[model samples]
Target: MHGSAASVGPAAADTPSRGTLDELDLALVNALQMAPRAPWAQLARPLGVDAATLSRRWARLRASGEAWITCHAAPSQVAHGALALIEVSCVPQAREALADRLARHPQAMSVELVAGSCDLLLTVATATKSSMTAYVLALGRDEAVTATRTHLVQHLYQDGSEWRMDSLSRDQRRDLAEAEDSAARTAAAILAPEDRALMFALAQDGRRSIASIAAELDRPESTVRRLLHSLLHGGRAVLRVDTAHVHSGWRSSATIWMSVPPAQLVSAGDELSRLRSTRMAASVSSEANLLSVVWLHTLDDLARYEAQAAARITSVRVLNRAVNLRWIKRMGRLLADDGRSTGFVPIDLWAPVA
Candidate 1:
């Protein structure tokens, strides 16, 4: 539930300080990771803080541009077919133009300017194989794009890599359990060190059995079972939702770029969300001019979305729709960075109920 979109590697250390996050901050973040839209008062209450402080901290986090709340969807479940990671080699000067073009595409999930092999890494999903092929061919037609390499996502274990939330301590865990007395425990905390060791091993191969986990963790099979169940119900920590790009029926998926007036954004976004085809939409900060990204299931669905947008926002731009050829690796790292995920939690996604 706690999600991040961060740059990894050596520069990862050079990243700016995240500021001091105390017990309350950690608690609030964990609550939000579970439900990003939870009410300020609700999150505040459990942490023994007031609404004002919670609101202030949240605003600071947002203002600092270190944390955000975004929606994620299962493309296959939405009837979109393929998924792909695109690497684009472009002239540094033209990178801005290329980014702008890709961001407008309805097929892209996320895009970033990297420092390595490819200047840009674009995650795209599409509806059908034919559509995916067409989308790629269109990119080839772009004169600005010198070369492109597509990596089909075979499977997704994790997505996003921002670490705005802090890890938890033992006392903090007890406090959480006490505060939310009736809530289910997170799956990550149930494992012993040995069990966790096994989990790490099994994560590399999802098919790893309890016996294997036990052997790896040097624990008994019974302990492994208990830990596995805990991981399942405890916020799904040990295992995550796994799916291939093209499953039984769904064919592909795509990212939709949108432009909206600053004034009309709230109202326009609300209206667009009423459509069933839209899985998730968010206002993002990008180097390109585009302001928003929407995930859609089908091309017809996309057309309908455009019509709706025309009535809501002043103008809508369809940059380029990339196809998701396959799913690559997904969320797999330890949350707390202590070889355990006990202390790491994300904020809730939806607002708390009255």
Candidate 2:
């Protein structure tokens, strides 16, 4: 049986959870949520643990496939690019096979099996709108796929990077904040053309050392460090520590589409952002102007969110809500049946879909 740490929120303090991880592991994941690549030595002091012990704990967590870290091109920097959510319908009994097939594609950022009108849900990113259109057309050609509904994202109000575990102390957060701000300020807010290769390398393994990345890029360690510092501090890149949500008590999620008055879109988005269950919320160019997703302890929890959203937000009409069944892939990592990382596909949002 899965233990209590898998329980959403938290169990009582007196409850002992023989779950996949103890309190320490959760704390580590929380700290990484703040500074994913902070040196072990720097992180140790903040967590009140030694560098060596912290390293060993991370090793165990990674080896068990209970947790991992990865980075992505920041949504803000890539706001000009084509990013959309596609609801996919498959032919009879072909959902799982098609989901697995699409999950391996580099442009398919995250693929989920769902319970609703569509058999699969896909989040795709491409360098241009035309390229994304071409990819969708290509998908329509697949014999297993019957229908698809695409929603072009208009604006992102919140993303997974902003979600935190809230396990760190004030002092710990202060230390981590200082580490993130230590980089020398740069004039440019986004990565230059040359930072592309380095950015993708970090996407592959977010925790890779500066020396390791330098060797891969065939550059001096000092130069690599400077570029990395700018890329991170400039907000052109995002690093997040994500576990298999199935293992985290947040076993299910729901995607909500809404039609809100133009006057209330910003306020609506802001309201949705502060919801505890919210993982992502954005404005989309469709009949439904607002789209949001929420994590829940069980499949039934979607109703509670829908009820609350309808009552709280101003004039928000719920167009539809679909419950996600399985995350076949997330942020380029393909998952196994039990939510463990089996492999990775290097996502390339900078490239046109060919």
Best by TM-score: 2
Evaluated against the true structure, the overall lDDT of model 2 is 0.78
Per-residue accuracy of model 2 over 104-132 as CA lDDT, tens digit each? 67788899998888889999988678888
Mark the regions of model 2 whose C-alpha exceeds 4 Å error after superposition: 1-19, 180-191, 352-354
Every candidate's lDDT: 0.45, 0.78
Error of 2 at 155 (Å): 0.4
lDDT score at residue 177, model 1, on the 0-100 scale: 50
Pairs that collide in candidate 2 are: none
RMSD of each: 20.4, 6.7
Candidate 2 lDDT for residue 63: 59
